[model samples]
Target chain A: MKYVITLLVGMVTGAVAFVLLLYYNPFVGNQSVSPLAVSELDLVDFSYSLLASDSIVFTNDGESHMQPHPAKVLQLWEPTVKMTRALVTILNDSRGQPAGLGVKFSSDSEKTRLINAEVVVDSVWHIYSPEHGTFFVDQTENFWPYLHDIVVPARLSGGDSWRGSWYGITSTGPGALGIARVTGGAGDFADTEGEAVESIAARAYSAITGPVAMTGKLTIALPRQEALP
Target chain B: MLKIFYLGIVMGIAAAAALVYIYPVVDQHREPSLITVRPNGGNSESFHIRLPGDRIMAGVTGSTELTPLALEWPEHDFLANMQTELFKVRNENDVVIGAASRMSGWSEQHGSFVEWVVHLPARGSMFMTMAAKPSADGYREGKLRAGTREFLTLNGTVIERFVNEADDSDSDNVGRIELVTALVGLPDELE
Candidate 1:
């Protein structure tokens, strides 16, 4: 009778313990909620510049793809479409410090005389170091020069806190000038609307030797955070 | 008193260990199901994905689920449904080849701008920029603008289709995306 009672007690104690363990399981709770709050900056106004050599122009004019066009602005006879992708430096009041990375892809068509530009910016400058090159903020790897591999992963891994996308529109001409607006964004620039004016410097377009000097001012209006009750 | 305390501790420890061992086995059965990629043949492949919940959509950068963002201007008469999404790309064999970004938007000034950037690691990346509008059947067709490396000189057209209304309650199926790529330019060896 004592053995039976002891066995019952053990079984009951074990079942209660198991239920408690299940109730407080560490892995079962909600992990999707981000710990970081959105930035409080109401308006972010910044300027950015892209050097000519930093941009690559891929044309469908049947020209040799290997031919070097470092300036990125190409002159073609046929009604061709050119896809240009550039890595630009985001600046603050023309100052280099606290600068960040910008990746812009523009598709220009001579046939339609239209240009569509998609720009992705990481304003905090998470993974890019001008002197030591590109390295992870966590210091996992050595200085890697490839911005293509670094930018996407940095954006994906949530290391890029100040990130957004601004879609721009421009027309094709001898000396082209265009404007852009905030189409969509994430992070600090979420629910934001702003305007930016982009223009190619006269010298960059006229001379093939000079780099494509692009200057633009971006004014983004961040949404106000709701007050907690 | 000491014996009872020791016995309770021992039972608690044993029960915790047993629960840890059994939890995974039970939890595996409760996880959401996933479907395989179904091929439509002739250069077209279709993918089935779950419709992510609102929590996943609101948190853009870090959410584990694939989130599509509305990228349209509110005031403009631009098509109401401008969106952009980035997700993993799989080949016909359903092996994850790389990642691709898709942006679909339309404006009265620009007409329709649908672009896909497919980045294949080590091999190269392809940019397919289509000016064409979606058909009545809801599929958009566009020409390949440019490529790098292996796809450098290839000319192709991609047909994209988003099929079926997602039945969120259905475990077997949720949604589907179909992509058909027809290439025109290839080297003699590849041809």
Candidate 2:
């Protein structure tokens, strides 16, 4: 009886093991499908420059399959798109009149509050309105360049307010793309000293106010006249 | 002795199950465009119409939940534009999953806007793309004499009005704003 019981147990165990192996990885014996080829995905980079000055950058890695119609190699598996926005805003005067705005597209994603901008042309001089507060933008330099600089200019307007809007310039291409936007920092010059830029910049000055939100669009296809061949 | 043999069998089955994996080359979706904006007028910054709820399509690794981003400057049409076109590859249910993304001119890590939480089974895979930001295109808002040369401030950012394919003033038209990804994320495994 003991021998029979031991034989029965052994047979049951062997059966279970066989079933598990067969069902779990039926292809284990074949070895025809290369593990590397099965899961292997190729990575490719892509970029597109819009008719406008804006540009896009991206990366993608997907299946190298053939298109149904064209039969062309379509990386159907991997797809990516990037857009860049040049942040700018328009304000209103007492007559409820509208005025011109400015924008600078700083690529670096680092740096929290500020972005370094190049004046593409000599149009107008800009300043931070105390009432409207300070606008946040990605710094041209590394992240947190002004880790401790929070001194508002001595001459700051108080109680006064201004209005404005933001814009984004995005673009894309075959594989990858890029999008740009002005760094809209969390808040005005974060007083490394404190959150009292109002008091510091105000300095018993006149009235100042905070800036308001505005709108714009992402111009992808630019006219040939406005674009470089 | 019999019990020991049974245990070994059980262990072998478990081990085989653990080794199971499928490299699914999912050509599930195409283009992966979640947003599109049509220009109505020649050059106008007007919120004339909308597409309701202003929803956006997101695709992540496998199937994972996502969160709505609270941008510092929400009011600007930026959110609107992002909503419709914030295209990200996702699972059937629509989750922004990311394990590996191959995008040029950019590098990305999980948990950027939404809380980053995702994992892959042993041989699982994930693929995604990050869209580039605007302004980096080099189109200057005309030019600036001084101050922060970026977004809205006291004076505001401006660029010279150019022309588009229509030869009309190159008004604000988001040519293409998208982000896509797809892959097998772990099945409810620790994120």
Candidate 3:
């Protein structure tokens, strides 16, 4: 009976601790990470290519998997819905130091038509690498869904940031041109307007989600920033 | 009896820990409510869940609170300033099924834009981009732009409402997210 009493007391204490930790913990709050300011620049242009090998694809009835860099084709059969989230590597042909672009889009069952698409271009944050890989602190880590506080591979810095909606066809073998319009942005991209013209390549002769490749040019005109005193 | 007190305490603590761990497991396995409503002869499925819990934003993990923002000048840290709020997607029955992320900002190009993504476990994910801003009553509504897997064939709208009631016990901002999806040509037997 004495042991039972002690056990009951300990249990109550544990419950209280759990409640406090769940409710009153001080670590519960929101914080934002800021980017650096940029110099005077009006027009910024850069190009990017899709890293098909490093692309991660998900489907409802089809297979969901990730193909590392150099992966050419992502295959799915009879898929009703498919989504591909891939990192587009910034090419070296930008007039100014090019930050980079991130692209994600979902496709219809045929995998040849694009449904919903979006792109983000930022000067600081990136998940691309030069040696055919992503920017995970651990090179082995390839997925982004479960990752947070990722390493900022400040590949290019000019305080340029933009997010926009993209539309186009996901056809294989020199696919149709897709375009993205700048909808919102910050820094050098603030008050700016532009569009991205993209073309995709795949080994499949027809509409198939296999062996994908892409390249695009991003051109945005930045508004003049008032010189700070 | 005195000697058993220490053992009792240890056993009690273990029991409490076990209970806490079991709660979520049971919650996760509970049958998800898949409510289907046909409006105008189209298959419409609605999911309503209160998202009054923790959030991981820009690497900061903590309980979420509805802190009003001052949308004035541009924030130098654009990524952080986007306030990419990420939360777990729970069903109306409070079953943890998936996760979601939402961010809203203003720019000269577009007055105000909101981007939100919802990922359903093994079911695929969907994205919604809305031009509408939140109202004084604390709700933002928009149409579903794109989706994958089960969300692909459906065209619908998502409304997120925030409930700010003063609870003396908990000092965090509690809110609810409602996803009302109207699927076109969705086979009734499709899961």
Model 3 chain A scores worst on lDDT over the 10 consecutive residues at A137-146
- Model 2: how far residue A69 lies from native, Å: 32
lDDT (C-alpha) at residue A133 in model 1: 18
lDDT of 2 by residue, B74-188 (tens): 1322222221112232332233222211112111221112111111111112111122322565332221111222211212122311222232464434232222221121234
lDDT of 3 by residue, A72-183 (tens): 2222221111232223233434553434323332222122110111111111112221111111110011111101111111112233211222222221111112223332
The Cα RMSD across the true interface for model 3 is 18.0
Tens-digit per-residue lDDT, B1-191, candidate 3: 65566555566556666765543321112244476667565555555445344332222113143221211111233222233344445555556555455655443433445666665533545666554567677677776655544665666666666555547686664555666665564455345
Instruction: Quote the positional error of residue A59 for candidate 2 in Å.
Output: 22
Q: DockQ for model 1? A: 0.03
Deviating ranges (above 4 Å) for candidate 1: A1-229, B1-82, B107-109, B165-173, B186-191
Clashes of each: 1, 95, 13
lDDT tens readout by residue for model 1, B28-51 = 011111223335312333332222
Q: What share of the true interface contacts does each candidate keep?
A: 0.04, 0.05, 0.20
Model 2: residues with Cα > 4 Å off, grouped in runs? A1-184, A189-229, B1-10, B13-163, B166-191
Pairs with backbone N, CA or C atoms under 3 Å apart (clashes), candidate 1: A52-A212
Against the hidden true structure, what lDDT does model 3 obtain? 0.37
Best by TM-score: 3
- Cα misplacement distance, residue B13 of candidate 3 (Å): 52
